[model samples]
Target: MAKIEPANGLKSAESRKSLRGTTESLALTDGEGNPFGSDSELNAYTSERQTDKYGFIGGAQQYSEHSAENIPPEVLRQREAKWLDMLNNWDKWMAKRHKKMKLRCQKGIPPSLRGRVWLYLSGGKVKREQHKGKFEELDSQAGDPKWVDVIERDLHRQFPFHEMFVARGGHGQQDLYRVLKAYTLHRPEEGYCQAQAPIAAVLLMHMPAEDAFWGLVQICEKYLPGYYSAGLEAIQLDGEILFALLKRVSPLAHRHLKKHKMDPILYMTEWFMCAFSRTLPWVSVLRVWDMFLCEGVKIIFRVGLVLLKCMLGSQDKLKTCQGQYETMELLKTIDTRYMQEGFLVREILELPVSERDIEKEHLASVRRWKETRGELHCKSLPRMHGAKAIMAAEPPSRQDLRQNPTIIVESPLATKSNGEDKERKKTKEEKNGKKNSSPTPVAAYLEPSEPSPLLKDTALLGSNQSLSSTEHDTYL
Candidate 1:
């Protein structure tokens, strides 16, 4: 392959001169075999300043050298070498370099390599190839009109600060609209959700429209099935699952939240729905995504647990919060330093979470969620969580999940005591009428309020059937 470098004096003046007029009509011609004409005269490519007819001296400024920050050049070279090897033999890499893949992903994928790596990790490339030209077919027709308007309104809201999506009808915005619309066409039952906008927008930043579309599909269908579905039932189920884990790991915080009638939905909806896109700092968001795409939803749960523990696990911090609303507000807006790219990446890797741990909890919590669906309702759980609460649907069958098996990474910290003995001791004390004298302050879960406006729109919430189909294929 010929290296395409600008006229930067790397070649001798003689060579540059010889390459000018000597160039042939190598380009494909028109129907008449006539070469396309250029209005500008074929001038010698030069680094020397040129004088125009008016005798004004002119020359282009030398281009500046750009490089990624914080990443050493040697490290980048090593990464490139590894990436090239993986690219050449992806199957071999997947079989023999699986550990390396996880390690490199944890170290943070090079920005230049992120798109290709993400496609490989998420199997987006396969999905894209499978549905080749499907995007164009979908693009030829308008999507559901209801979602069209909503997607249009939300386009400007996604990554507006980034150059790609900043301008109206810019490449970024156009591609975003096309991708989201195609999704609605592909899965009308889900239509457009507020959360999918940011997710798709982020993917577009990394890959081309077709690849980004498949990446989005992989995320919606494989990584986090049912997350963007009507009513966000998947998120609701995950939210309860998160709480169940929280109770085991951070009992004090769980008890405090229960006492104050603070629901996980109040703070966790964005974290789950958007995969922490709008919530985490931009740099941290990218790093989280690298792991999330490679490891699946377990990364989301791990990061979520870490964030919650840092935010609310401290007894002293919880003591200062005057009420549930203030605590929720505090939880919503965390310190920027904690979410900084380097620090957050370090924490995510150091956090004692493993895929095996998440799987076990996911299964049990899902079952518990189904059993407790009648007990939990939309009334007290904030409406911002989306759609309405409903009875848990039947879990995905085992056969459906055979294609995407969860990788089990064991962690010593995975198994934590749920404080069952403490619960028994407290209950025994209560039976002995010692509840009032118990040292720990008791905070009980609150009664339900009347159904909110969110639940009233159940008709528009649609069904989770589309999500269930994909969810079974990925994480059942």
Candidate 2:
């Protein structure tokens, strides 16, 4: 049984005695024999002393153990310095490797590094200062009449339905137009070709107008041979190359294409024309462009191979669809970048040069089959005529049509219908004769009139006075 004692706050004579003790037997009592301290207080003091002793010993042991193993201040400082040096060396190594990579010219440079890397890759940086002055000089001169017409016709048509184009009031579109127009003025022989629009749009994604113009010049002159020639012979040759790559990368898919009488020229026309802008969404198109600007023309062939490989698995499903539906479905389902950056690269790097050449020959055989049939040539016509037919069906403004005589004559080609073409031409000639006989001057079309807000705000015109009689005739 536990003993209980009376509580008394008292001190002992020998030294100053505490009221709380570990053992009740050691408690000092007064002459009346009353207990001086309680057993509970004694037990509590014992418990507290035991805890304190254990805590002190534990702390001492921890300190002693840590002191032996812990690093010294000087040693820690040296280790930190050494680690920092290693990190700096790694950074230097990476910088040197990046410089060497630029020289080697293997893959596309990453997007963040595009501007500086492209300048270096194209040797445009060497002539950067000269380009601006040259561009300005070219801009002041009158451009070729054919190119001017082509540029004006396709200006609004470049990215008409794209949200990015519409949101900025076609600023990107205007920049693209200026560069292309300037380049056409600079190089009259190449002039303004159809494929320039898509290429210009891709340039607009990364660069300012001047830089993009020069970058395009590099692509046209150095990277791609004969790109902007009058008959687009260079473009046709590139299509041949892409077809050869597709066959080598995916033979089963290539065989399926031959079975369906599919010509690579049929599907890949947009790919070459727009650099996949019209064929792909904006994001994916930009990724391909990033690679394109870095790696030069080789990336395009690699990317084409990737596109074919992506479609290989789906060829069976695609063949089930009839006619145009199959082609459309195949294009829609294929994952373009994944196949290019992954599967095809792995396969291509492993093949020997002799084997690759043989595969290319096989593809050439398929291309020969397509060429003999005249199928490739037939497929290359502009797809815009279909939409132009819809636009022609809309009620024409009598005032607008009659105001410009040439508009009535040339507008029928927009419909692409044989019956309308002959009828419209005959009518146009008769109308022109009557107008010439009249006493009224042709300058009536050029009379000062308030331009619509849309037209007025556009970057197309330089000044109100620069709008000439020919310009009014063209616009009408």
Candidate 3:
């Protein structure tokens, strides 16, 4: 429902009237009624909207590199060069020097190439390639009326201040709707959740609708399993783990939270669900997302913990929080001091929480939760952190793991038995003084070029999938 200007020379009123009947096909057009996949310049219509380097179209107080200190143009150029090298040689780094790749992500990807890097990080690009035409196929179909209605209502609220979704039914909103609707169609059982709108909107700001859809897919399935599903089950489990982690990371914050009996969900739900897209300032949001996509939800936990320590870790900071309401107020208005991109990213990197530690705590949390309830709404645990982990958990990777290596037997059992008998007969004939007239016999043996099912060992429990000699590369 973007405010379409008449100067653009396009009639949106008719499109609006037909939307009810053509909602399924709406993904086929841009805001100006451009062809579906034409991808007409997304932000060409900025006009007089005051935008930032990040394409934020508003006059509001935005926090970014300017708010603190700017990265010098020279250094940014060097980093961009290095990023280009890493991207071109992505397979080399991912296979051998992955630690270096991770270190590069912590420094932050250049905004110009963030969407491509994000596609690499979240495994979305690969997923799209693996399952071609799936997003379009889903987009072509009408979404479930129950979920589509809710999705349409929430479209305008995704980033009302941002240029993309500023117009109610602009191209941005149209793309956002397509991505979310495709997801619902892609995953009918999961249906939809309100948190997904902002998340999808954030992705649309970077990538096209199709890539954004796959990015959302990776987020839901590989990055944060069961997060947007029924019962809010996975997120609740993570909430408990976050509190438990808080006890160790910041004991004072833990004591303060416990004193107020504050549950993590009351505050951290949006933070986790939206991946802090809604909470942090724009650049800070991007900075955190750069790490979040690279490091997984632990970065999110680290961000939450870092903020908690800064807000209520000290005696003086705790004195103001006399009750739950004050504590909530403190958490809601994240002071700009703590939101500075540089400081927050550094703190997150140094946080002592490791994936092993989180996994340990996760298992403990799940065990405790089951003590009270015999079953969890969603039994799927969160996948391990990082893009490598994302690809490793994939079916192709598992299929490789499940493969039984080919074992060739070169023994001459079939040929050797006949040859040994012939030699014995020849020795017997020589002892009996009989003249030998036959040619010398030699044993021959070879492995078959193709494996015959008859020669296969039927008792072994394994998959028939063959293993590839070439390693799976993390490149386009």
State which candidate has the highest TM-score.
3
Return the lDDT, model 2, position 48: 46
Ranking by TM-score: 3, 1, 2
- TM of each candidate vs. truth: 0.63, 0.49, 0.72
Question: Would you give me the overall lDDT of model 1?
Answer: 0.58
lDDT of 2 by residue, 408-458 (tens): 122222334544555676678788873323322221112112121122332
How many steric clashes does model 2 contain? 0
lDDT of 1 by residue, 374-415 (tens): 432212221111000100111222232123211122222221
* Higher-ranked by TM-score: 1 or 3: 3
Q: Rate residue 52 of model 1 by lDDT.
A: 32
Model 3 weakest lDDT span, ten residues long: 467-476
Instruction: List where candidate 3 sits over 4 angstroms from the true fold.
Output: 1-49, 59-68, 395-476
Best by lDDT: 3
| Residue 23 of model 3, lDDT score | 21
lDDT of 3 by residue, 1-476 (tens): 12222221112342223222112232234564332323233344446456776656552324455555577878776776676566655656667888887888888877656776787778886787778789889989988998899888768556655656666577888988999999999988787877777788788777677878988988888778887776666776888889999999999999988888887766677778788877777778888888888888889889999998999899998888899889988887778778777788889989999888788888998898789766776656557697778756763332222212223333356457667777898899999999668864442322222222233332212211111111111111
lDDT of 1 at 342: 71
**All candidates in order of lDDT, best leading:** 3, 1, 2
